[model samples]
Target: MRAIDLETQVLAAVERIRKGEKTENDLIECKRAWPSNNKARQLAGSLNRAAGDAVIYVIGIDEKDGSIHDTSDTDILDWWSQIVGQFDQVPAEMVRHIDVPISNESVVGIAFSSDRAPYVVKTGSPKPSLEIPIREGTGTRTARRDEVLRMLAPAIRVPAATVLESNFSAVHYPPLASAENAANDYRREESVHAFGTADFFVEHDGRDLVTLPTHAMDGIIEVGDLSFTLNVTPDWFQSETKAPRKEYIDRQREAVLISGPGVVPLRVDVEGLLLSHRKLLETTNSVTVRLHLGILHTSKPLVIEMELNTNPREHQLPEDLNRWSVRGK
Candidate 1:
């Protein structure tokens, strides 16, 4: 699934639950409070039943009536980490929690998929056994061997990855577009860069100041004829960097709408502009001015500055405009 404004998404999803618009399914489960004791084991079991689908466990809401519980004392992230580690070692990116205004507690969202055959529960002291957990109606039970082999069939059919040891094409660019290999149109060609401004929003009730455009965002501005595009897709190419061991990461996704910000195109930079009084390179070096708003996302205000960098390079400039557009090596 595409990354969304976590804070807004969590709230909207929870709101749907409250209004009876959405309910649990094969890929979703809801919890009432922080998972502890037996609840933690049950949490692991639910994840196992997900079977590599986009599964979510909306925590802090009553499964029966969708009542919101106070979360002041429950630290969602800390609790999430403890549960994931004790039950099954899932990647940090796979499961995450978001805080909502509905309650002091936060809601958790997990998008998990695995090529590995069986994801099991660890129930032992030293020698832990891998017992594949399978979904049986409302709950989960250990999977039978025949069931597990079915799960592992895909991984066995293809090598997980192909290692390229020598010469390489540009990592950012896609491969050849020929009869054998098809190229994705949206990704392969360079996209036109959209320009905009960004502002910092701070809470009036004594809170931290933060950059605005990244989250709960809204903007409007008067400009020439222009249309906005959602520049959300990332390059499909993966870095070839082979690393040793690993390192530490402190980056985190925001829990609440400290603010929710997203991009909107106010105008388009095209041939009509008076750039050098000519429309020859109208598509190149064309500036599309957009407003980087704040108060809409949070309880704050913003001011514009020209000397400061107002260029929001959320997308790449056209291939012809880019300096490195020179052909050949």
Candidate 2:
């Protein structure tokens, strides 16, 4: 599920609980405060095995009375580390940290899913042992032999990812496409630089955990009549790199590896203009841009579409073009 979707679900659950109404989903659990590291590990581990779909552990409200509890001071990253530190080989990207704003404060939620079941957590005294804890209807228990075998058996695998977050800014220079400036303007001119930032994460399979490598991703941008390709170059992509183990990160972060930021450079040219350069002055004030991305492992392609102003206000331009002139020497 997308982060926003998780936030919505948690907010709704919180409201329902506050009104003394029982939520229909047993996969959701509420906590008054951040559980101890040990407890946090247990809850995460159990939920990893228990959930057949998206499950979440929300913190900040009293589970019993549904009263709002304060947990704003906790660092979300630290809390995430606490959960990741518990297991040696927990399902990859098994948990995502979610922040929900409520009553002028932010609450923490942990989203978990695992198909690579038997996500065993390390527990016990001097002789630590791996235990596969499964949550069964609000209760957790050790997985039975048959259950363990079922989890271990080969299951259908579908590599996937979701756009966790994305933001972009673009401008279309209508004047540059005018027939009057055909001689002054080059065939192509850089219109928008630093197009945007995007975070993509491998979509979790409830029955099995999945990882989509960042190295296998490529993208393209289409604006008006122009199309350009984009690339995701993680540090590990370099041959001389010594970065830690690299995972195929699809814009996913934290428990999921977040690929390096990709800056989309857009060049608008007279020839690429959708309308004839002869009629460019009559073009509308805005143009639609689309970004299409594909991952080597996933069949689904990520597409983002946005509109940019062809002739922005004076303040939006880097320089006052009205005061400038393209005069022949």
Candidate 1, residues 223-273, lDDT tens digits: the string is 224433322111123335688523111112321122222221122122222
lDDT to native, each model? 0.40, 0.52
Q: Runs in model 1 with CA error above 4 Å?
A: 1-16, 19-22, 88-93, 101-117, 124-130, 155-329
Tens-place lDDT per residue, model 2, 140-212, is 6777887676566554344344444443333344446566677776745434232444444444434433433
Most accurate candidate by TM-score: 2
Give the clash count for each candidate.
Answer: 10, 12
Model 1 lDDT, full chain set: 0.40
Least accurate 10 contiguous residues by lDDT in model 2: 320-329
**Total colliding residue pairs, candidate 1:** 10
Residue 289's lDDT within candidate 1 is 25
